[model samples]
Target: MPVSFLSAEQRSRYGVFNAVPDIAQLGAFFHLDADDRRRAMAANGARNRLGWSLQLGTARFLNCFLDDPEDVPAAVVDYVAEQLGLQAADLKGYGEKEARWAHQEQIRTGYGYTAFAGEQWFALACWLYKRAWTTNERPIVLFDLATHRLVEAKILLPGVTTLERLIAALRERVAARQHALMATAPSPNQAAVLENLVKVEEGRRVSRLDRLRKSPTDVSSTGLVKALDRHVELRGLGAAGWDLSAVPPGKIAALARFAHAARAQAVDELAGDRKLATLVAFAATMAPQSADEAIEVFDLAVGDLLRTSAFKATKERMRTLKDLDTAAIVLREVWLKIRSVAEIPDGGIRAALDEMDLAAIHAAADVIGDIAREPDEDFQEELLDRYATIRRFLPKLLKHLDFDAGAAETPGQGVRRGHEVLQALDFLKAIERRRTDIDPSEVPADLLSSAWHRRVFPKRGELAGTFNKSAYTVAAVERLRESLRRHEVFVPGLRKWGDPTAGLLKGAEWERARPRICDELNLSPEPGTDVERWAATLDFVPPARRRPVRRRRRPQRLGTPGQRRDRQGPPGAHRPGPPE
Candidate 1:
């Protein structure tokens, strides 16, 4: 049978009041569908219409008492009991079961107060909805099934009752948090938490704005757009507005342009900053058609941000550009020519590359890659000279590049430059080989290998040729060697370049060099004994060869005729042997 009302046995099993579902006693309640509610009312002895009215009234009084026991009067309880057709004598006999019946009736009817006026009831519903909304990040809905209407509910924060007021409060809070964040330079975790809190406040404002945007009955589109534009500016969202699916096509571009102006303001505020330079480079990539405009803005911002005296002071500190003290005027002329070709002089090249500030080089590379395709001989010659100079400086310059402290873009930037550097080197090498009678493969492997290894490896300032500058035990080295040999790979040694430690054999020389390394490290090549040297040792002998031992056969019993004949023959054989 379908469950109409929860019997005592059923309530003991599934009642919310028994355990309330959550250990913390959070929002927990029993819910019933409309059909179930109707059936529950019928099963709760509400067979007649008056019985149902009495049940609902008793439930309302009980719920009111549960919500505020001190506020509900004793007369209201007596009135509810009288409406339920319970006499004073019957009320005196009411116990836990009757109280449970009233609570269950409230669940069935979905009414906390049957006597409240329509407006007061709606207000109470709104208050309940707000309580649930502010408790968590969940969306709350207030719907009236009978009226078939939706109620817009808003949480009333301190001195902020309306949605507009709430948004203003959140916007102020975001500005305060941003100001505090800038003032205090907190730890990364602290800053992240503050940033997240600000985002949360911003999210609430966006949500409210979005709701307002949809309901044009009250707010005009012009006012809404103006408000949204200002919000984007305050948030520093620079050309980025999200959740535009509901926005009209005519409005998107205007909103995006408004947001992008914040990005422009950022350029002015954060001038000469390398991080901002990176952003401008990215903007240039994304908006290639308008790259000139963006680049011009970035250049102007950087120019305005840089102090003039700093340049003069820098030149004075350097004293001279040339390592050989050439004339200052000549050096300046040479520098102007170098700047015309967009090349960094040798002194600044290391600092430039080390910082992974490739914005300047990126422009140069693009120009070179594009222009090098020209068939003009003069242009090709000029390109070759410029590429040769760049290639010569980079190999030395890249060695001192600084990597980021944590898991940052430092590694990625280094790798990107490393690839570009190799391409130029190979291009130069191809030219050199074509000019002379040299083979391309004849390039110095050791020098190239060392440079390439140093470039990609994350750790620096450690001794070369070790697994992050840590020694390996002989057993661990052997296991690693066996694994590598099985896989047919020989990589760098596990020990530091000069550390007295067990080593790994690498490359084509592994077979020839293993025994020597073993000797130097004072380790036995054999598995168990020190006396047994490496297999390739000159005096080492292969283990002795051994023949299998023969087993003696058991004598046969003299039972069968053949056995008996063999026994007699043995007797005759003893006499024949004496004769022999």
Candidate 2:
């Protein structure tokens, strides 16, 4: 509980004037009125009067009188003397006698100031304890607040070391209490689970906690699945459900930070209470955080799948371009030959058929038919190639994560009437439960875009009425990803992917604050008035008065064709020589 947190400079300057008082500080703290002047005048001689007045101003400004009452800035002395009509030099022989000590006692009693002892000391300690227990404020901030509190309460400020020690002690006490409260929060069975997190088991090099703390370096489908597994493992421990409501959020956050940064071995070496508290904090914090990370990983994985499919589709299109060009030429030649034959006599058709390369025309028709079977415009078919990869995590993602519409007209109806994405999720979840059979009418057609609709339901053949299950699932998951990004749908217990409007002012809160908010933003209380003002501003500018924008012209190239200029050598390297 030593005052080690404070720097030497801070401790030295405490309860003393480190610099000349500013104009405002002098006016606020050092200004003495008629009653102060009268009190100083009551002291018999000029030296006593001046000394008394300095002590009074020092107490008011510094909240504590210095050991040497005469020790103060010249500006303070001159400012006080100018008011009292006495010279600053009269303070020379002020504290030489016992009169100075007598004057301090009189000042304390007459001005309603109490010494920092007994009841005052205990009361200040209790206040510091309450502040430390409730908040995780920095020691320096608490120290400054304590100083201000002492000044306001008319209690003489204690020594810097004494105040710092009090704060350090109270903080330590609060931390111990918090640790104990969190340590006993879990049952014996749950405590064993938390303790096992730090202990290395047989056949494993690292502890469970160490393994859980590591994030996936790869962002593939496999990586996304692993992230979801980790999230499930953390949630299964039930650490988030622990009764830690009594502990302050700041305390939990501090412990979480320590646990995250410390090695498992270091945490294992801590005392029992500290170790348990650290583990509980780690579990609670990472539960929700892992959920967010899993979703983010899934998002990246889906984006990669779409990008890979699009790249493949582009490559396929490029490969078919040559075939398409050659086939078009062959067809055009045959068509012209047929047109010439049609104009000839009836017997000329036989001669034209015998002269034509019928095998070449047949081969071209076959190539055209094969290429036309799967059109290049259908990119969704490309995504279908990776449906197995999507299935690996999509089922788990749908199972573990719950989506919400964030707000609804009534409770329990949001999932039904919320965003179209939620409806699709419900449909997919039902398909997951039934696995084998799917009803085509149950498809959420509104959730499907035009591209998806064509892929999901073919126009002819066996697949015409029976929808493509994989295509539907992938479409739903992609739309879910998009809606999550747009904040149209939210995941419960997640802050990053949670409701975006949760922090906004709404309902009665917004109603109460509307007038002040409008006033601050320089708008009328009536929305119509503000809209009219904006309209007026827009109408004030005439098209004839509007200035046309001038564009900067590009400089012409001076170098010869196929001759490169070396612009990297220096500032003027690209410029030509004077004559050569």
Candidate achieving the largest TM-score: 2
lDDT for every model? Answer: 0.33, 0.85
**Model 1 stretches with alpha carbons more than 4 Å out:** 1-105, 108-175, 186-388, 391-445, 449-580
In model 1, which range of ten residues has the least summed lDDT?
468-477
> Roughly what TM-score does model 2 have, to 2 decimal places?
0.79
Q: Write the per-residue lDDT of candidate 1 for residues 157-179, one digit (tens) a residue.
A: 11112322333333334334333
What is the C-alpha local distance difference test score of candidate 1? 0.33
What's the C-alpha lDDT at position 453 in model 2? 82
- lDDT score of residue 281 within candidate 2: 90
lDDT of 1 at 262: 41
Candidate 2: worst-modelled 10 consecutive residues by lDDT: 561-570
Residue 216 lDDT (model 1): 20
Q: Each candidate's root-mean-square deviation in Å?
A: 29.6, 8.5
